[model samples]
Target: MDCIHLTGIRSYGYTGYLPEEQILGQWFEVDVKLWLDLSSSGETDAIEDTVDYRSIISLVQDSVKTSKFALVERLTASIADSILALSDRVTQVQVILSKPAAPIPDFSGKISIDIIKKR
Candidate 1:
């Protein structure tokens, strides 16, 4: 299947195990890959023939900004599910959520979770 890759989506959200994280919020980055047939779009060269990625980006941003999930795993799954709900043409989706500001002490590395959903 063909894939649409959307990367570096940044948003401020309040999702974390720590109390301060939920209250103060932090920046989150999301990367999504959508798998679907691109033949029709390639043939017709029309916007309607393919998924509008603006919706996906907006959804990802919204999910991160408004969600209260404590687990990044859950958040990634939710994103995959939500994206799958957006279009019937999408056969599969991969979501990679990155938490660059994790609350772990004495840690300078980032944390990320990747999940894939298939229709």
Candidate 2:
């Protein structure tokens, strides 16, 4: 299957296990890979024959920005599910949700959840 990849999508969201995180929010990076057949689109060179990546990005941004979640796992699952809902052509999806500045004292970088789903 052909795939479209969206990487390092940055958004400010409220998704964490702490009070301050919920109130103030933080920056999150999302990476998504969507699997679909692109033969028709490639042959026809028609936008309608393939998934619209800009729309997908908008969906992800809206879903993450306006919502709050306590677990990256749930957030990833939600993203996958939402993407799946958008089109039947999407046979599989992988989502990575990363928090670059976690609240942990010892942590210097990011923590993330990665999940793959197939329909």
Candidate 3:
């Protein structure tokens, strides 16, 4: 299957376990991989034949911006499901959700969840 990779997507979200995080919100990042047949688009070179990635990016940004979930897993699942619903060409999706400013004391690393879904 042909795939499109969207990387380094960043947005602010209120999804976190801590009470302060839920109130204050924080920044998050996402990387998505979408799989589908691009041969038609490649041949036709028409806008209708290929996925309009702007819509995908908008969907992701809107999702992260308006959600208030407690776990990255839930957010990722929602994103994958929404992407599937948004486009008929998408046969599979992979979502990687990241928390760069986790509230864990004395930690300077990032946390991310990776999941794949197939239609």
TM-score of each: 0.98, 0.97, 0.98
lDDT by residue for model 3 (1-119), tens: 99999999999999888888889999999999999999999999997987999999999999999999988889999999999999999999999999998999999999999989999
Estimate the overall C-alpha local distance difference test score of candidate 3: 0.93
Cα lDDT for residue 97, candidate 2: 88
- How well does candidate 2 score on lDDT at residue 108? 100
Superposed Cα deviation of residue 69, candidate 3 (Å): 0.6
Model 2: per-residue Cα lDDT at residue 10: 85
Global lDDT of each candidate: 0.94, 0.90, 0.93
How many backbone overlaps does candidate 1 show?
0
Model 3: ten consecutive residues of lowest lDDT? 13-22
After aligning candidate 2 to the native by TM-score, how far in Å is the CA of 72 from where it should be? 1.3
lDDT of 3 at 29: 96
Tens digit of lDDT per residue, candidate 2, span 52-103? Answer: 9998898888878987888878888999999999988899999998999999
Query: Over 4 Å off in model 1, which ranges?
Result: none
lDDT of 1 by residue, 1-119 (tens): 89999999999998888888889999999999999999999999998999999999999999999999888898899999999999998999999999997889899999999998899
